[model samples]
Target: MAHESTDTASENGPELQRALSNRHIQLLAIGGAIGTGLFMGSGKTISVAGPSVILVYMVIGFMLYFVMRAMGELLLSRSSYRNFSDFAGDILGPWAAFFTGWTYWFCWIVTGVADVIVIASVYVTFWLPLIPTWIPALVVIAALIALNLPSVRGFGETEFWFALIKIAAIVLLIVIGLVMVFTGFEHDGARASFLNLFNVGGGFFGGGLMGFIMGFQIAVFAFVGIELVGTAAAETKNPEHNLPRAVNAIPVRVLLFYVGSLAVLMSVVPWDRFDADNSPFVMLFSLAGLGAAAHIVNMVVLTSAMSSANSGIYSTSRMVFGLSTDGNAPKAFSKLTRRQVPRNALFLSGVVLLSAIVLLVFGLGESKGFTIVTTISSLCFIFVWSIILISYIVYRRRRPQAHDESIFKVPGGTFMPWVVLAFFVFLLWAFTQDPDTLMGMYATPIWFALVGLGYLLLRKNPKHQQLRRDHEERIAQEKREAAAYLAAAGSRKVR
Candidate 1:
């Protein structure tokens, strides 16, 4: 019904089309959630957490599954709400929308920036070792902008293929790992068996308190884009039906790709043998005796990192488009192209994304620069996910009837939010443990301060006031329509 209204083409401009199909939505969620964190960064994660990282992945996965469920329910409850920020604004206030929308935008902007740097730096080692690193970075930015500019479906297609490749790689690794395990494969004197998990090390908690704490610090980031599906709900076909499926698959993904892969890696190669500098994926493949193992792994991670940057551009553009429509950003950003794409928003994001090239030029080196950017980015994502959880709590309290009647409800209900909230607190404490992560914690306040300053300045602007009023009016109108629909249903039942 909301799509029916926006698709009619009013003065405000055409709505974001429902171009993402079920498969597209599912893979987009998978693609967004699984990135360099698992592919490239997992090597470091395993080096830091050892076998305990497996539990870290599982625990984070368990908590965030409910977070996704809560998000899935909220998006389905109101079609008029374009994203979590919109519903957050509607349910919490305009201020919540302003904060969440812009924070979400900034979150991806930082991530996109970091991703491009990674793209360029990784290029030097692999495909274009002879080419200038910045060249590939520029080419990737330009190419993704082209893919995104055409239509939502075009972006979906690109992401679909990207996700497919990652999935195929993961599945292949798992299958090979299984073969090695069954045949008692030995590589470089390390025997392939499940017992290697505890036998070869100081046991499953191989990493002591410090290692365990850092595990949360590192592993939390891998789950950063887990909620990306919520952002795409507006452009998804039958979101009410498709979104839940996407969200539900997160646990399975975590278990198979993360927990399963790590389980096999540690089993095949001793966790202590895992180098912080190398990919566990590459090492595993090389151990399994792929002659071109280095090249294959390099290409897989290259494509994976590129896919992540592409997702950042796509998500950031949409978020800016949402923010603009909400009157929190420039009106130009809300303007759509003939294909219903947000050309202005896409450009704004791309220009900002180009800043990543500066990191390449300045040469903080990808290792150090990526850590700094991703740390801040991860903290920002924690803030965003917390808002979604808080919004869910508010939704349950204010709209009990709506929650009661929903076809797709979060299974744990009121209790899980508290449990997840505690997990977040522990995670924040975990961030305090390492100097690098602690530095990120300290850096986070500057962003909030800047946003607060912006909010204060925008508060007095007539344009912002008008946007606020428009958003409230839209929410009010949806309430009226929902009431009428229910009334008609009641009448039909009486007859």
Candidate 2:
């Protein structure tokens, strides 16, 4: 009945349409896993940890795969739940709804800023060295905003092609890299071989224990958008079927895309050879004397950055719209256009994106600006992800029947969430080891303090209090109905 209410557009307001198909969901998930971070940030990570960065990626991917599993199970548990934020509000409380929704919104904005920086500084400037960086930054922001304004399906189709391009590029890199390795391609007298992963540089832990720990700082950012599929839950068609299919493929995607590609990259060029500011994908072709291929890869990386910025704009708007509808944000954001696009919320994110141009104008060079922005983005996303895991734990506790009936239960049973949380704490400590990331870690709490003050003020509003009361009652009623239905079903089976 609740699902019915959401799908039926009201005369008073337009509801979000379930326009994203199975293919859209699948590609979007794949696109989320292969982010701009890999294209641009891997060079920094490789430089810091050498060949050990490959292991670093695998570990981060391993932990995040469980996080995705928790998210999948939570989304499938209730058909009426719009996204993780909806369940967070219902199960954790109103404070969580406000915090997680807004934090996740900020998460993408920060990530979009990083993506725009990479687009302008790393990829675009690679070709147009004489142009002002802000020119391209502004152009990218405008193009993405226009791409998202028409309809949800337009965004989906755009992402689908963008994701396809990224896949093709990575596949091409992996293929070329393998051919070079097998053919004994030599770069500066270092032969292309699997042994190159360890034989050169620091030999695995090239940067030492601290370097290995530091690898996670940038590596985690690479996985930031992996959960975009969870945000797209409401728009996905046949979510129960498609969501699991997409999520279940995460491990394979991580291995092939992140681990497989990086392993080959280091073998072909060795981790020490990568320049921190340059994209290794571009570097690989350039070093191999394939200038045309290098240019092509640069274009692919450019689109990869655009794809990430595109996801940031789309996810941020949907989140603000959800927050506004639930009385967590300004009501204007709740308003959707005739095409079911949240124009107000969309522009809000686009406006915040201008901060990218400011950073550029101030002369924050590619390497420094990206490090700072990505560090902040990684911390915020960890909070968003931690909220999802916590929400899942609470879901299992408060609604045992729902867990029992869940067709897609999270693996490792109830124990894995705590394990993943501990790993996040390790990552937090990793941030402190680097001065750049530590600066971001220091600034992150200011955001929470500000949001905390906002929450206090929000609670005093009489209208908000009434909305909270209504939401609490609805959640209680839904639980009762779910328990009763499960009981009846169990009795019928026994009889």
Candidate 3:
């Protein structure tokens, strides 16, 4: 059995480059926080939970913010940790890396498929009702592959603009909505005022406890890509300086982008009035008699779908690349092009993404297909996030000195990770309460079973056995060095 290269910078080929500047990192973080779910799924969420949907977004955001902070502390703890997969491998053993890496890859692939389907079925068909859904789907798949192949910076640049468009659209919606509320704008004799939120159908919880619980099933998918900052941490130019900044601002982003936007939308349109199948953004503008602006809002929502798909491609490729380098995946994926882009992994994801075309051309029906993919994507993402928190808990027990010396500790410390994990369990229970999501929940275990089987077979390979040996040796060496350094510091302090 041959020993694999532990060097991230391979002696035989190029590695991923640190081309993403602070601006790119900031926007990538923002883009990950905002997903197509906000624009496309918010209508359904509002219908399900009514005005209380605002609180759902805030609570989910708060929980995920702690997950990001835990990730930030772990990534910053060691420069060698390319992402959570690396640290999971380092701290928990090789199997953790294998499962986390492949699971995260699958998570994004599911998300990308849904994004492309929405682009083709919902947005493209809006303007070109006569065109086949597969046309735009294929076009989007090709364009995202091309956009990412050029460089990491290209992906960052694309996300920056895509995210900016989403932000502008939301800000414009909030501003217009406020004006409507203050002026007592009326349509069908229902005045647009702040009171409308609680005054409508059932008040804040008008949907009742059951409806509010169902809101979690719909809204959790909106935050699926929030951990992307962890994936991009290695490629960030100044990770220590920039990663915290990117993470610390998540609460503000959630409040403004998700909570703030939804509040204003519900305020202007009244929660019960929003159509579950239509974008609340489009509805808001259309009601204001801004037909042209409605079209523009439609375009922004279109770009938002594209952005999510684009991010899916970028993160999946990078994750597979990490898996390959760790000997969890094929060697070919570990090889990078001269541009420092993982071309092979990128093409693989794009090829798989073309499956969306089949779904589009066949008759899954846009709404049903979108629901299936988003449900599965949301469930898989929860698994990935739980792994991050689990790894953090392990890191804390193993490295208390590191935690004490850290500046960006998760606010509630070890206690908070347990709380968030409990919240996730409640979310899983919420899924069973709804038939649409329950099907996905039942289907999710098949994926894990397959991955578990693959891991079992890979574990038997001589090459993997040797790599595991090397991985254990590396962890032991790192522990010895850290202990020596801490002992020396203690001695100097005594003097």
Give the winner by TM-score: 3
Cα shift from native, residue 196, model 3 (Å): 1.7
Best by lDDT: 3
Which parts of model 3 have CA positions greater than 4 angstroms off? 1-13, 365-367, 470-495
Compose the digit string of candidate 1's lDDT tens values, residues 60-175.
99999988888888888777767888778777767787889889988988888877777778744476677777777788889989999999999899989988898888898988
Per-residue lDDT of candidate 3, residues 1-495 (tens digit): 111325343445446799999888898899899987798789999999999999999999999999999999988887777888988877778889989999999999988888888788878888999998999899999999989998999999999999899889888889988899899889877888888788999899989999899999899988989999899987999888999999999999999999888988888877888889888888888887896865797799899889899999999999999888877888899888888999999999999999999888885646664676778889999998999999999778667677777878889886999999999999999989977788888889999999999999999989779868877887787578668877887999999
lDDT of 2 by residue, 1-495 (tens): 112222112336547888999999999999999987787778988998888888898999899999999989887876766777877877777888889989999889988888788788877888999999999999999998999999999889999999999999889889989999999998777888999887787688887887788888878888889999988987888898899999999989999998999999999987788899778988887766786976797788788888989999999999998888877889899998888899999999999999999988987756654577778888989998999999998778667777877889998958999999999999999899888888888888998999999999998999668757866786787678777877887999999
TM-score ranking, best first: 3, 1, 2
Tell me each candidate's TM-score.
Answer: 0.92, 0.91, 0.93
Candidate 1: 10-residue stretch with minimal lDDT: 1-10
Q: What is the C-alpha lDDT of each candidate?
A: 0.82, 0.86, 0.87
Candidate 2 deviant stretches above 4 angstroms: 1-13, 365-369, 467-495
